[model samples]
Target: MSSSLLPFILFALVASISPGPTNLLILAHGAHNGLRASLAPIFAACAAAAAIVWVVGLGLGEVLLRHPLAQQVMSWVGVLWLSRLAWQLFRAAGEPLHATARQRFGVGSAASLQLVNPKVWLMAVAVIGVFATPGLPVWHLALVFLIIALPCMGAWALLGIGSARWLRSPRHLQRFNQLLALLLLVSAWSALLA
Candidate 1:
């Protein structure tokens, strides 16, 4: 409840809500499936991200960041994963919601991917290194993460659900899927360049 914690919580919320690979994927899932289906991945992602934040907060992230090769490897992995996702999205045009939901990555798999996802890693590092106070209790940090990340991510998922309403026809859905795929590809490229 300290004033110092507020900034960190807000920062975490902002970062979580911002468009990124994870959010994009969740949005795609929600649009294709439903808001309920999106929840699994969102929870998984948040849990995974929280674990990374906790580890990094304990000082492991700094060590990982120091290795240039590691960062490059992560970048490449992220690009590959996202590219694959993009391909799937492109192919999902005109597909049934059930098929799309089945094809969507599982929560655990998506969560595990965060380890190699540059955006998630960067967010984890920032949250742990910048927002979290060194002397503060661990529970406080956990609370901050839960308070901020859950709702932010949930909102993104909800957006996808809302978008689904607009896509009534197969052609419209196809175009929407293609656009998302393109966006995912661009995001992957951006991550690689970063």
Candidate 2:
């Protein structure tokens, strides 16, 4: 890769691996359900983010980037959605695990939710639009994103799985959930400032 490409790769990796709504939600899913259950959402999110990046890198994302109002709208929507998620986490802090089949993660709503997910949008705009050179062949950009996103999301899922061991206790799980929720809420608030 050329020297210019190196920065793009690093930016993609950092954006993809950093803590965000998708990561937190996946972690929660892994903890609440299991690693297997978390796979669906993780893969779905990865695919969705990749698709968005591809679209953005192709120039569609430019429209969004140029429109400040649209960006603000997205930011607010993300903040609201994350706030709602945080509330749910706060509420679930005291709940008991029923261990139902439906609780397991799957390629369902979670995957589709990436459409409205703010973190994914931010990533598409910041990394794909800003870092990825528009002149590059689309396939090359796609390949780079695929290589970077897959393992990064998997690492998050694995972290969640690892944390599950310590969250076995209902009380401990509850506290963890609450703390995670608080963090999410803080993230949402921070988004408003950004």
Candidate 3:
């Protein structure tokens, strides 16, 4: 790889793997639902992310960026939507987990979030703005992002699935859920600000 491209590779990896709301949701879901059940949301998030990269790389993001009113409206909606999800997760944390998993966040629900998630919007815009070149085919750049990002996102789910064996106690599990809830709440606020 060219040294010039190293930063983009590192940025994509770190950004995807970082504990944002999406990854946190994956972790929470995977921990409770097991790997098999968690597949829907994990793939949903990946699909949404890749879609973002594609749209932004194709320069459609400029249309949104040009319309500040549209951007602000989406940001507020994102805040409200995320706050609602965080509230539900927070309340769920109080309840003890059962052997049968509650499959709440499915493919449609998770994929729709990309529309309102400011972090996703920002990441997509930033990646294209910084790394995409005029000469390169936009889809190729988008594919690079997809290739690097999807697997990194999957790792968060893996961590959660792996932890299922370790956090066997009810109390430990409750605490973990509560903490994830708090983090998700914080992420929602941060997304609003971003």
**After TM-score superposition, what is the CA distance of residue 92 in candidate 3 from its true location, in Å?**
0.9
Kindly report which residue pairs in candidate 3 clash with one another. Answer: none
Candidate with top lDDT is 3
Q: Please estimate how well model 3 matches the true structure, expressed as its whole-model Cα lDDT.
A: 0.78
Order the candidates by lDDT, highest first — what do you get?
A: 3, 1, 2
After superposition, which runs of candidate 3 have C-alpha atoms over 4 Å from their true positions?
1-4
- Write model 1 residue lDDT over 17-124, tens digit each, in one string: 877788788888777778777778888888787777778777777787788688788778888988887887788778856566677767877687787677877777
Query: For model 2, what is the C-alpha lDDT against the true structure?
Result: 0.73
- Superposed model 2: Cα runs more than 4 Å off: 99-101, 104-106
Candidate scoring better on TM-score of 1 and 2: 1
lDDT of 3 at 165: 76
lDDT value, residue 9 of candidate 1: 71
- Number of clashing residue pairs, candidate 3: 0
Clashing pairs in 2: none
Model 1 poorest 10 in a row by lDDT: 130-139
Query: Candidate 2 — worst ten consecutive residues by lDDT sum?
Result: 96-105
Candidate models: Cα lDDT each: 0.77, 0.73, 0.78
